[model samples]
Target: MKRISRREVLKTTSHFFVGAIAGAGLNSVLQGCADTSSDQSAIDDIMKKTEMADIKNIKLTVLYDNVLYKKEMATYWGFSCAVQGLDKNILFDTGMYENTLMSNMLKLGIDPSKIDELVISHDHPDHVGGAMMFLENSSDINVSLVKSFGSSFKKEVKERGLNLREIDQPCLITKNSFSTGEMKNFTKNEHALVIRTNKGSIIITGCAHPGVVEIVEQTKKITNEDVLLVMGGFHIMNDLGTKTKKIVHRLKDLGVNFIAPSHCTGGEAIEIFSKAYGPKFINSGVGRIITANDFI
Candidate 1:
């Protein structure tokens, strides 16, 4: 494939937004048709289901994290991962630095122009800082963020003519894949990912401010499947070892099969989880690449 330069992407950006608006108009018309008849709704449902691929065929790559899994990749105080081998190449969160994110992508052979969609867990700088710069001239314009994001951030996205998807409830992001929605609680309102697999369900979070265990339990309700693996930052950097141990026990009690905690999960928490889950603890960090083969 021909690599599209940043200049070329900017030149074509206007056309892309126009096409998106036209497509939205088309979808609105179709939505009315499907709403008026049960058969149309059923057919739409089948089409959506057909787009889904089995989890065993999926690959998850940690593109950006505070820890380094590959010696050549740089690490920053943020999180970003790529979910590929599905209907769309989903880019989850953008790390703290633009150069680091792009350079790492180049090293990993991830073409920016090929990303089909972007999912932002929350509005934190670590999670969204690089994205702001990455989106400045990129071809990928579709972004899904929680509804609670600040007006300035939303305005910036709209001003750039990007397709802003403000999700307030748990919804199907792709076939057989879901967003745990905006986890409304004590911490920053966040959204975690839930992908239903043949084996069970996989949950991916950015910071998991509401609690990783809570997010996993939420996935059970969202996808109606047993928890398979949970990855990403747990945001328990300040938790005491005793507290972390109890949290680990609770996660096991909830039937969590595997874990790959990193970033803000803290050393104490990571150690507790590592000891508890044993071999099931998959090390997570920048440059960590996980595929269906790791689980199934």
Candidate 2:
């Protein structure tokens, strides 16, 4: 596992974010702890007998519909995330097609073989373009392909015998989930999807393009935690005045509670992250349904 060179892994991940900003900004500390509240009914009464894993009842369906879905065309956006479960139904990125993402996952009834897992965050095509029509309509849905543009698409992803894994680092996928591999690349091949939830860390990205605050400071420096929720795309469209309010006050001084932001995250940068995270911001498209029990 000494194959570095992706331009020296983006210069050693930008020198580990400039030596973690003089030893404390390891993307600005988090050390596990996140309940980024708008007080979801007091976090639903402290997770009300929390032990969520087999997805008791969850749903986030948006097969693919650009223009950030709404908010009046929000300066043209793009993203496709479909997450539903009672027992493993996931489809992170697959917009752009698949018959309009299987007629918007059959108008959100979602039965692409109960969609086990299909994470393709990079290799754009509006995020793996409906992932080969969800493997041509569920070939026993068990996909895990997460490689970013290399090995030349691995022979049509190994002739669709997929279950591929080209993730270069950071692991776990089920079991307090994680996956930030092949990141720090800047141009393409970017990655992000860590979900450790007992109260913190629920990062998910698609168009971050390497710097969504450096991919949530490299997933809290590879899981030190507390980054409650950092939805998607903060590519900061053309940095308007005061550098987008100092990048939303440096993501609220790195205590990032919640900031949905879809597609290229424009529309005046979601109105400067809704006036610098006023209500802890929210607006992720395609039938939103974000949960956090530490991603079970």
Candidate 3:
């Protein structure tokens, strides 16, 4: 796997838009929709249609990440997961690069065209990197994202003719699944997904810029259910000494039964969480799968 710096990633992403506009003859259409801002009022009007009914089992497959679990899976600096056994198949985040995302999906036997819902945690390239590529393959699904994303990004979704649901408050994606809404930290805005199972709720995050503990607490507030598993990037890689440890303890205190950190979660933090959670810690890397029965 090749290592890519954030600067290089952003540069390449900019070039992608340029190439897409010219090659797809979308310059005029893109420009025409550029000023069309997302209608927050309309998005707010959309309500949850179906609820998950006491699902005893749910499966989450890590499709893309910075860590590799299978020998053949490509590792990259991003996160994407497939949530199954819900009312609909949900895709959480689209990894950093187009080829890597598509290749990993292919290897995992996942067809992007079959995904019913796309939930973007934030606007970062690592999380939304494969948006255009995946959208090209499938526009038959609804896209749920934070309102804080760039206007141009929202415009692109609208222009592509996909249903866009802009969220700012905690809401049910389906009856048994929920979003933590848009949580603001000093630097970024993010939302974490919560899936209800007979055992407990599974909270899935992307980078967790707003703080993993904070997101977990918000999920608890919404569902009033204990979190059986807390997975995905915790974003505390640079936390020097006791900071990450404190966060780990806090999560344990909050009744998180399992911890499976990956991507931006540093190695040292994972070790701390592993020790703290003991057998409850599951290795979360690209190609890793966690089923609800594992928790029960």
| Residue 275 local lDDT, model 2 | 74
lDDT of each: 0.73, 0.57, 0.76
Clashes of each: 0, 5, 3
lDDT of 3: 0.76
Q: Tell me the tens digit of each residue's lDDT in model 1 across 128-175.
A: 766755456654357788888666556555655666777666655676
Could you give candidate 2's per-residue lDDT for residues 122-213 as a string of tens digits? Answer: 76665664465554444444444445454434333444454555555554445445565556564776777666554566677878877777
Model 3, position 174: C-alpha lDDT score: 62
Task: For each candidate, give its TM-score against the true structure.
Answer: 0.81, 0.29, 0.84
Instruction: Report each candidate's C-alpha RMSD, comma-separated, in the order given.
Output: 7.2, 20.2, 5.9
Can you write out model 3's per-residue Cα lDDT over 126-210, one digit (the tens) per residue?
Answer: 8898776656666467778887776766665665666777777765576567677778876669888888776777889999999
> Which residue ranges in model 2 land beyond 4 Å of their true spot?
1-91, 95-115, 118-128, 139-194, 197-200, 206-225, 228-232, 241-243, 248-296
Off by over 4 Å in 1: 1-52
Model 3: pairs clashing at backbone N, Cα or C within 3 Å: 51-175, 52-175, 52-176
The candidate that wins on lDDT is 3
